[model samples]
Target chain A: MSSSLAQQKADKVYRDFGLELEISNRTFFNDGIYSGQKNNYLSASIQPEYYLEWSGGEQSFKAVGFFRWDQHDNRRTHFDVRELYWQRVKGATEVSVGVKKVFWGKTESVHLVDIINQTDAVESFDGEQKLGEFMVHFSQFTKIGTFDVFVMPYFRKRVFPGREGRLRPGSEDGLVIDSRDFSFESNAEEWRPSLAFRWSHYVGVLDFGLSYFNGVGREPVINDLSTFNALYGTIQQAGLDAQLTTGAALWKVEAIYRQNEFQDILALAAGIEYTFGNVKNTGIDIGLLAEYLYDDRDNIALSGLQSDVFTGVRLAFNDTQDTQLLLGGIFDVERTTQLYFIEAERRIGSSFSGAVEARFFENVDPSEFTYVLRQDSFLQFSLTKYF
Target chain B: MKVLTITFVLLSAVVTFGAAQTPEEKGLNVAVKATKADEGFVSSVVDLKMILRNRQGQESERFLQNKTYELTEDGDKSMVVFNSPKDVKGTATLTYTHKIGSDDQWLYLPSIKRVKRISSSNKSGPFMGSEFAYEDLSSDEVEKYKYKYLQEISLNGDKVDIVEQYPVDPKSGYKKRIAHYNKDKGYRLEKVEFFDRKGEKLKTLTYSGYKQYLDKHWRADKFFMVNHQTGKETELFFNNYTFKTGLSEDDFNQNSLIRASR
Candidate 1:
């Protein structure tokens, strides 16, 4: 009876979706330009999801479709199927099939272990959105832990903005490259099947996850540094993510061991977030965050966070509208390169919100990848209204 | 927050009494009795619409879904997710209102894809830019405040017991709050008056549209809060309430807030 009642409460053939229209003005402060020029443009996207769910049926179906249009960047104007899946739960086992997004990680600074779906890079630089992948998945929840296995049949490549978008790697005395000028490692494309397994459970106050994946890498190996051409590589990775909540502090760690054609590397991010309830008797709150990121490959790593330390502060007003600020900086522990960033957000009302972000790079080394894009320091503001 | 939570040890500092039971004990007894009158609700889910009117009479509206789960020990857990005003849609807040010490609160921002813990110091701030304060969202528990019976009086043609309560936390925005309970109706809360730390009336909240659900439980379907200092008002209209939702504690945590809008 309770199961039927829960089904009744969630019964639906058509669920919910929304349209978001965003306009951004990007400026590059430098004597030279590499990929995208200083230009302002508007982008709009619509996501409508459908669910064929029965009040008493054991099987359920869902589909989500997303499409976007950009004013300047041709590659940004595209469409994707975020999710289209069917699932069923019987006793302790659950099964699902079709295209879907599976998230697998813990930690704030980066999502090191979440690699089921390829990132829709043009959507945002944050690597949060994922393009759905075709897969057959199964999971079993038991008293010991929950174990999941996946058989993925296809792959999706990472996309970059058109020649007009901002934040591209500098090449050959600041030559701009088009997003269309992209290639693969070889005859390899999407169609090969991949295998993955994950186990997660709560041990006392700690929630931990162990994942093993043997698939085509989501991130590309920079084959040609001058024009920044991406060559997707095959990789086998074992990842571990864990979090321990103790009082007002949370201990977070994300570690990944991976092997590709060029090298075998182990990377880790370990941090503790400790919060002090009220600051100076004011209702506003502040938190101190410190994390250390390390990679065995060190300086030659593409993204260049190797052997770095990041510390930041978070402020929360805790009002009904929810206002917050996060400011932090990452410094090379063994080098002179440092980067600082600020991210803030607040609600305008029930229907709208505003966000602001700023990033500045200082003392970048010539050998580091960040030196090329040193002029990309920028401030971004966006106002989004829901419909 | 743990610092202020540690200060909650002062709650045990209430002066003890001897022969003549003081007004403090009497007011607390009334509160405890009223709290016990409606128990074992387990869980509830409700939909609410909030209307805000400025002093100039311009108005705006917000829609949300609120879910509450009762805890036999510690505090009750509640989650609220915005459903309308397209910009703020899918935003959610999860609160654990402790029986003692400070409450634990977190807000989920979808744009940043992160969850932030709320500072306990600012519970008195306006809720959603509305007249209601953050503390107003709390589920009333006798332990959250220390009460003193003011008097028995007739308020707005109804006989009521006027009581004054002081927040246990020193960081509370209000110096004290006044609650008028309907004396003849099993001590039901009819109205509340909030005073700032400066001892000035800050806001007044009125409850009406009494509704009885599950036979024994009573809930106010309409709540109107007016900010005396700012000359603004917010009216909350509850659409429906469902009890015995069978919601578990796992549904009121950080993970739930991430998908609250979904």
Candidate 2:
């Protein structure tokens, strides 16, 4: 045994821990807010994570806890255990069982292939944050690729902010619907079974994934359309995502096919990002991205990305502060609706950073998912500190 | 008798040419010999602390761990994982340095949950707002520079060889760089002075307290850089170097970048 490595291996406490706290305050861009809540409200969150690795390197455990308190919306005030899992790796195979979050696909604007974890929509409309799921997974790595199989025994439903939340955008008649009123196709509710299989590989400059999942739909279908009450249905989905790099540009594509008792649908997102490094020979680098989103359901889709084009630009300062800016817009080609968004962040010092996000909607069609929230355009600012 | 005279003149000419080597040839010979002393190390792992000083003399510190997998040909792959400065902790940068062309770089942001490919053309830009530019920490290779021997001199009571070199890449911000190596210490690198594109002195880098490992490789324990233009400085302290721990190519690929950050 190498003496230096052996000495390091003697320490059984290969562990790490961290805590993060964030607060966000938002204000509306329009004075015609229908919810009757105060223009500005406060939302705060605390997250703590812990990790441990055995000296033998055969087993490891990780846990992350999250809690949030909101002044405006009761539903927005919640708690979640994002991860608490034990994983073991032996030879070319690995297995893990616990509450965990698994992310898949390679698209920026939409994630059609990621279905294992429930979306924490209240955290951010982007669906980047997810609530962990209880599951048992087995993965094998081979010369050709990695194959993973997951069986999730418990399911978590999606979250929406309270009635007083800015994005709540009350129904057509400004009626606030409580989440408790929603019904499920199966009385089992959280005990529904979910199965997923994914195969991912890299060949030269191309990276790709093929995945299939069968489970209760992540989004609820509106039943008794006038009441805004919904029912959760079961469905099966198959997806393919790929990306290729050539020079300073990356080409990406994501496609999915889903089926349920009511209908079968197809969705796709394709885009390209080209980087122009150091504009004017300066420290800033910019990337131009454009993508088209299409869904067979047209305006009936909930996410509202159907038959629309998304264009965005990302700027990176490459400074010690790690400053960045991203601005994007989704424009409907068949209608006169558009959604514009911008996010900027920069480090205040070594341990603290600040961010601002603004979202706007114009000429939203009533048939679109976000139409009710048309007048909810608002700006948000947050500060995050790590220790 | 005619053939003998012709042979004699040819032999004399060959001897004269061999004695007077061109400056370029001599520089290349020195670099080759210096690089040859560090062969067969395979791979190495290290942890380092970087100290940044601004013009006003204020200072800050950052800690990082790094692993390098050296390929037999082409370039070496290296990944650096940040450990301190809570906001940037868990951030990582992966680089594939090629001797013949610009390097490929990727930055993994824990907040964004994505690995972004960054521009390598701005290598002259300051590294994390420090005196050391991105190009300064480049993986040293013989083919990356064109060298010319300046002279042999005595400095700091030691015999040293001075050489001037220009970067092979056109996007390089420096017009040229001058390096000094101690002749008595097996051509060990000791110092370097950088000149900007306008041919003005920009920065000076010094290394000392080298510790040898694996019986053949030498690594400096302390490295410092001073920016002449901005009166800024940065210091690097290297510790716990381990060589040949069986790191493979698979560990240096894009897929491993996520693992490296954790």
Instruction: Give per-residue CA lDDT, model 1, range B1-262, as digits (tens).
Output: 8877766655444434335558898889878878877777899999999998989998877789999999867778999998766666778998878887667776787644456554444666556657776679788888888999989998667789889999887767788999988776657889999998889998899999988787778789999999888788999999879899767665676555654545
TM-score of 2: 0.88
Tens-place lDDT digits, model 1, residues A1-387: 277787775563435545665545444445435544554556666766665644333456767788878777787888999879887755456688999777777666777888788888878666788788899988777767778899997877777766666655656565554434555443556665678999987654577889999878787776666657656667899999987766567788999998888768899999988786545434466778998988887544557787889899998875556788999999999899998888898878566678887878889877777786577677777776655
At residue A269, candidate 1 shows an lDDT of: 93
Reproduced native contacts, each prediction:
0.29, 0.26
Pairs in clash, predicted candidate 2: none
* Chain A TM-score for predicted structure 1: 0.88
lDDT of 2 at A162: 75
Tens digits of per-residue lDDT for model 2, A4-51: 766665555678899999998988777545545557768899999888
Model 2 docking category = acceptable
Top candidate by TM-score: 2
